[model samples]
Target: MSRTATAVPPQGTPLRRHGRTKIRYRTRGLAWAFMAPLLIVNLLVIGGPGLASFFYSFTDWDGLGSANFVGIANYVELFTSPAVLSAIQHNLIWTGFFLVVPMSMALLGAFLLSRVRRGQILFRVLFFIPYVLATIVSSIIWRQILSPTAGIGQALQGIGIDWFADTNFLGDPALALGSVAFINNWQWWGFLLVLFLAAMQGVDPALYEAARLDGANAFREFWHITLPGIRPTLMFLMLMTVIWSFLVFDYVFILTQGGPAGSTDVIGTVLYRTAFSENRAGYASSMAMLLTVISAAIVLGYQLLRKKLKWEV
Candidate 1:
């Protein structure tokens, strides 16, 4: 019988493996050392206030002085209060408007812009200009544009156009919220277009060519290839839209301050009024908690849906 030969171990193999492991540990330690300062800052700035807010939510802390525990009274009032309820309703309406209007406009605009080979950058810059403008500036500009007297209505009336004559876009309680949403959308949709356009650019050109060869039209290619390719960006933006719609403060604060008989009041405006205006810090903290909970629930729901649907992105 032939003797089987065994393979010999390479010299210094264990030492080499040990050296690699040591190097990996050193790299990790260096990374942590670099990250430590920022981590500490975040803990102090964000985490500290977050914990304080949680503590204050359960107490009657009026921004200063001794705290007295009031349990869930703030929360009970938050749900039952008419103002809070109206703000919630407005937030829902705002969410619905943003989810549909801007998203659709961005998708269509991006798809169209993606097909253009000339002046694309110029067009993008033009579209994105409003997004970069300060919210206060944009709000002020829109306020002038929507002014009933000596505004767009007056200018149009000069041209003998009767439409929008004596129409108060922001002043009228019936039109206030929708008008604000429209103005916000003006600054928002372009930002979405740029992002969606960037996402669309990453999709394989080969697929588009193949679809064209298969006699597919613009709508079909967009429906199938473009949408699937940009789904992750779309989903992420949609998630942010929902969150930001609830947290919206700047435009509403600047434009109407939730006025015209509380027609434009949202959760953020109400929270601001409660804490600073009314000196109800504890109640405001509870509203803050409500916002935090709602945000968390939305994120959790998205995660669950993603898992359940087996989404790849």
Candidate 2:
């Protein structure tokens, strides 16, 4: 005798409530197809160039000439060169200042703004306005403002302070790097503040409520709740700052052009001077490769730290 198979529904359940499982699979496949173009673009634009750069770093290809193969000589020379070493140090200083200046100020601005009631939107717009302006435009504007004949310098001179004529904002080696750093922080803070504000808005309301009801003051609430809520965003911003610090070229190029006496030369400016200005493409590529490695190490270390943090949480 042949046995008959029976289908049974356990408990109170709806078996034929919606469409068949096949529909879900087809929907996922369609979604993947829609995302295909984006993936291709990312690979082509970002990944392709990165791979090409890595490959070129090993060869000597001067703009229009044939590539001559050199082993690790480029890297060897990079380590031996004092200018290169100083540039790397300057890059680190830039990164450090960026974290302390822009990121801290932005976070503080976000924290304060979140507590404000009236005209929040207006403040957000005002703070973010500077970021919308291009680096070159801002640099030019600052140049005029710092000029001795017409702007801050003139006003100072009118009071017998004479900051520009006496102190040399752009000409002094010791102060030029700080000047660029200030410009960078001033231009970037608005964007970062906006980002922090947006991220803060997404934090869970219940967490704040609970913290308040538990005898937590505003500072306490922020320490325990707000910081935890925006930890991920903070990590991301930190990483992005590090990457951008190393890749800084536009502002440095336009504003100081690697400084009055190479005092403000960071990795990017150094690389540009080598590759284009001095016609040492291979050497520049080697410096670039080292920078890439450093950036990767930082990002990787942060990711590992994040993973550990998640586990602890």
Candidate 3:
């Protein structure tokens, strides 16, 4: 009572607490050690170049000289440039096409594949094979297949079919953009199919069974259960599709080179031309910044939507 019954410390308690603390610190240190190499590499590669691009965007650097600060002149030109505007318009069209066509095809294909009890693996392999092919290889193959003189058109003409006999898919300004998109989609939708199939496989079978018991048809079951189950993957892929559509260069560059009167010219091709072909690196940098800003805005909009919708995914 006199000394408030001076509480006796539990023996080894402090040591036990200190041991846990030391272990936590050691664990954290080990994790950082494991992450250090990758972090350093990203900082050097991605971060450094990103910072340089941002700095050069405001300048008038012609790729090999002193960067003279021009303060938004490049940005102004980037916005006002006719070629850039045309490229952006094409990019928007491309984004719309990919957002609809591949996504729909993949979703339908994946859903059907999910119901298959046999030969599913073979189908998957066949579908994914095109996606695994190198872009250049696929582009070349499609180019040959779409050739006006010796391609499907000629093959069909041999069979007394005159539908595509005169069609120059890649050479016609009206057809070039669509032709490139179709070729890209041929290699793209399959990849999306595989991913959607994987995501669908994770959906609960019980839900489908319940839907069936409630007399729900295939489409209804898919609409209610399958879609919600794989929404996270769906949303993520759509986001990436939007970003990638803006950055599409490979297929266009290889097959069309944004040719046929620049009908298929996208932001990527324009940026390439500005930077290397035209020796306007600063203007190209500003274009890069525009792409970055657009991508960032899309991501931020997605985040806001997700938050507002209280999406658990």
Candidate 4:
């Protein structure tokens, strides 16, 4: 005869629940403890300065002495001021150029590289070299290369090329902004290529194989398989491109100093001038606030897009 066994529930059911709750609390406490140092550093470095800037935006402080609350006066002036408007327009142009030129070049370069077998590492290293170069160093180098008197133009002129011999790139108002953008793009697109290449490598090899089996050409393979596979990285880089374009100042400041009649004046340059050069720190703070708002809006918009579209990245 077989004997039947009866099951007994766990003893001290309330005790187990309490024990689990206590463990969870302890784990959370440890996590917070581990995060405390980073939180404090971030607060001191970013949060503090950000808050001070926000406060200063509403005041008429000249970077010294007492601050008087102006109550959006600076904002009104910022919107109406022609200099500010011109700077904003330049920034928009910069954004447009970066979003189109570098992004396209990077995508094409990365796609071509992804198809190559030999010398892939060599090519990647060569392309990434420019990105590793210091901004000031590159700006100085380009400035020399573009100089009408002693630069490549003159050197080429000695070889019977007169096309660029007399062209004053940074000195001409018409070409200053575009020249700066071009220089920045030279240093930027390589980095984008590397990033896009990395993203492409993460794509499933099987997808490309399947497309090839279906008699897909190189362009078709890239369009159908590669682009979709790397959409997340592409979109992210585009978003950052917009933001960084608006914040661009280093090359412009170093190369042209927003000169040739403010042709290359960006929001960043304008802010620097208004604050330090013009000694209108309060107004500059307002400009800073505007930049902050634009950056935050872009981020928030991206977040909303991700949530609405359910992006896995």
On a 0 to 1 TM-score scale, where does candidate 1 land against the true structure?
A: 0.93
Q: Candidate 4 has which clashing residue pairs, if any?
A: none
Candidate 3 wrong stretches, greater than 4 Å: 1-29
Shift in Å, residue 302, candidate 2: 2.0
lDDT of 4: 0.93
Give candidate 2's TM-score.
Answer: 0.86
Q: Please give, for residues 1-313, the per-residue lDDT of candidate 1 as tens digits.
A: 1233225445458987898889999999999999999999999998899889998999888997888999999989999999999999999999999999999999999999999999999999999999999998999899999999878999999999979998999999999999999999999999999999999999999999999999999999999999999999999999999999999999999999999899999999999999999988998999998999999899999999999998775
For model 3, which pairs clash? none
Instruction: Give residue 284's lDDT in candidate 1 (0 to 100).
Output: 94
Candidates ranked, most accurate by lDDT first? 1, 3, 4, 2
Query: For model 3, how does the per-residue alpha-carbon lDDT over 167-279 read when each residue is reduced to its tens digit?
Result: 99999999999999999999999999999999999999999999999999999999999999999999999999999998899999999888988899999998998899999
Local distance difference test scores for all models: 0.94, 0.84, 0.94, 0.93
* Candidate 1 CA-lDDT value: 0.94
* Candidates 2 and 3, the one with greater lDDT: 3
Ranking according to TM-score, highest score first: 4, 1, 3, 2
For residues 212-258, write the lDDT of model 4, one tens digit per residue.
99999999999999999999999999999989988988999999889
Alpha-carbon deviation at 75 in model 3, angstroms = 0.6
TM-score of each: 0.93, 0.86, 0.91, 0.93
lDDT of 2 by residue, 281-300 (tens): 87788888898899899888
Candidate 3 TM-score, true structure as reference: 0.91
In candidate 3, position 275 carries an lDDT of 94
